[model samples]
Target: MKLFFAFAIIAIALSVVYGAPADPWNEYKTKHGKKFGSTAEDAQRKKLFLAKDALIAKHNSQPKASYQLEHNEFSDMTPAELSQYLGAVKPANKTRSLESMVRLEMETRQLPDSLDYRTDSCLPGVRNQKQCGSCWAFAAITPLEFARCKKHGALRAISEQQLVDCEPYDYGCGGGWYTNAWYYLQYEAGGAAKRSLYPYTATDNTCAFSSSMIGAKISSYGDLPSFDAAYMQSVLQDYGPISVAIAVTDSFFSYASGVYTDVECDDPNAYVNHAVVVVGWGTDNGIDYWIVRNSWGTKWGSAGYILMERGVNKCKIEKYPATILSVV
Candidate 1:
């Protein structure tokens, strides 16, 4: 009995000597205690950031990583720019533990969009390597076809580059408005091709319109009407992902992991440099969010699109469907 007691005592002492209580809350509060923002908006974001460490740590054991995908444009960056360049990297890990493949990490606006989906004219699927800003072209066309799939029942795949190289009024190589591109597709002849026809090259090259026979291409859906948030949601709900944008604040850049909230309503357009897609959304921890898909590649913002502040004007809007639509 004496020998057993001694061994037990030694084990207990060693355990106490090695493992100590860790209070992430105390450290977080202490480090950020004196940190104050310039205004109310700034102060809110500050609070959200301070809580970031704890939130990420809270779920560290069960870190959900089902956000992996191919072709991340933002790659090989320095730690200093991790937050800002989130629109660039694609995470190497892909987790399937979570039932869904995506999650929203920030609050977002839940307003309605006033546009239409044209399945015949929309892009087939998501494309990549538009570092050349040809994204203006790619992003614009996919939704057009999504509209078609919604009302017309046309499931044909449309090529965004086809509009870039062929569509008039809108320059295929340069960035342009999505609405205008649709106009060109309506009255233009040489502005059409299948996804397998033109393909994508991330690089900016002159319009090399061709007549390839890889994928199916359809005619435009005549003059359409403006859209509202409900309409966008209707189309998006029926389709898959829709491309959208939100104003990212300083906290957005500084954020490392976990849920994003209490963002500064300063510019209402902080991280306006990047673009992404709206995938899915649901509520957790009493906060509303929207799932977004980013084109900056992968390894950026939670996995692709970091959650934006939804509800209220935190993300600066109350619209549904949010931004552009994507049928492909």
Candidate 2:
């Protein structure tokens, strides 16, 4: 009995020390999972991640994970290239993970064949949905904003928060897709609450009318091609960056800094992550990379983005592409 009591005390102490481990990732799941899947089951994958050293020992040959900056673009790029491409690096720039990956993106000129995964309304604050678990709305609606700009020759930030608050016709905050969001906005007569009108609070709430609210008449592209590398590249080359979803890497959790290539060792199962935006692609130092935007806020990653390898292109946006737009 005494031994059991001691073990119980140790367990309680560890819990307090580590803080509540109630899947601290739950908050992460709700926000990022929106576009990845309707249910958390799709967005998250289970994996037993061993420590870096342990992983090396298990793999025996050393997985060749580049955690340090021996070849990162920021460290390797010349001053002229840095000035033209990256400008001057600040102290904070030293720690960004996607820095090396973006070098490949900057050189790419490939454009998609047509507009896709974009909307007429180009809104900001993808991070706001983290609380609401409304990532799909952000993912689905963003393409609309960019597409409309290209189609109409105009530029403006739309509102994802408005979608969160105004579209009571859908699943509220639990989660919904961009296709459904487009339908919701279209049915609401093309007037969606703008960011100022209905900002993202991350909580499920009632949709109240606001005067300043403005949004595009949500439209569809018939049926978008499956979300894949070929499709994503084609869209970017022709239209622009396509808002997309994919399996996020769990090492994305340990990603304090450094460019992420396939060489970066991580749990594959944990990589089934969801995200929005496919900026562009290119090659640097003879390696291919994909430029991607993220909603985790600029402070969290490569200025709220990441560089994925072109060959590593995986994941399929479940639904067809949709977009956000300006109502007036």
Candidate 3:
């Protein structure tokens, strides 16, 4: 018994050093209601548990950080695996410059010191993207919804299903650009249908769009100057929400709450794999952040939203924001 105790103490010390705690099998199972089916399943579950424990430790190691991490459906996933689930695939061709697309006389306004569109009743409810890489579709359509709501005084959930299925310019569930989705909405589909009319299935299906069922129409879309938060703030105040692509990494996937600022994800040349809407911006504990609405369900972040680090363009969020012109 003395020898066993010594070994257990050593094990705990080693775990502390390595940042991976002993798997709390019972505790995890209790929290998630998860059960392993077989010996192989049990091994997989154990692996995931270790990964989760390591991530928890990593999160706790950061001192004075604004955010905290939580265990969720993605706890089991590696950064690569999480990338598969996000799927905001950008097009291979270079995107066109915003200067050529915007009308010369579009009205504009400046934001207050801080702004949150959701507070003004601009945004709708949180959405879940599921396993599809259709975050581009969700990010693209949400601003359209905001634009329509601002013009017509009624918030409507535009169909991402239409963009996911019908737009040939994009890769559908495999991946696509949010800007291409805007072009598709303006010219191809003539506008998107209501989500109630064509609910999301998280899979690519046949195009069921009809011109007669159009709920919102966008005349044009333009990009914010790359890496300009000041311009983005003005656009958000004058227009509505904007679509943005980000360099999603392991840290981003594990994010739960507070302002996220990761140097690894700050690489502008890093592949932009996930897309979301920039609905607002604010500061928390002197850490400036952009209030972004994610489509990973309300369980993922702070009610399906993330407070991303602002000013420095963490995760390259400031690089690819696009505004839409809605004709409600």
What is the Å distance of residue 144 in model 2 from its true position? Answer: 2.7
- Model 3 reaches what TM-score against the true structure? 0.86
Candidate 3 residue-wise lDDT, 1-328, digit = tens: 9999999999999988896854476666777677767988777867876877787778767797678887777776555567656777766675442322564243455557688876667588889988888999899888888888888888888899998899887777888888888877776677788888888999999988888778888877777777878778877777878899888877677678888876788664577889999998998889888999999998887888899988787888987788786564
Model 2 per-residue lDDT tens digits across residues 1-328: 9999999999999989997666523443454442334444433322221233244234333355433211111222233322221111111232221121111122345554333222224434335344345666666556666666666666546667666666654454555445455555665536455555556666666666564566454443322344345644654655555655554433443333334553333334423234366666656555555665665555545555565556454333322232232233
Stronger candidate by TM-score (1 vs 3)? 3
lDDT of each: 0.43, 0.46, 0.80
After superposing candidate 1 on the true structure, give the runs of residues whose Cα lies further than 4 Å from its correct spot. 1-126, 144-157, 168-174, 189-192, 210-235, 238-243, 248-259, 262-275, 313-328
Pick by TM-score: which candidate is best?
Answer: 3
For all predictions, the C-alpha RMSD in Å is: 14.2, 15.9, 5.3
After best superposition, candidate 3 residue 126: deviation in angstroms? 0.9
Clashes (backbone N, CA, C under 3 Å), per candidate, total 49, 31, 0
TM-score, every prediction: 0.49, 0.55, 0.86
Q: How close is candidate 1 to the true structure, as a TM-score?
A: 0.49
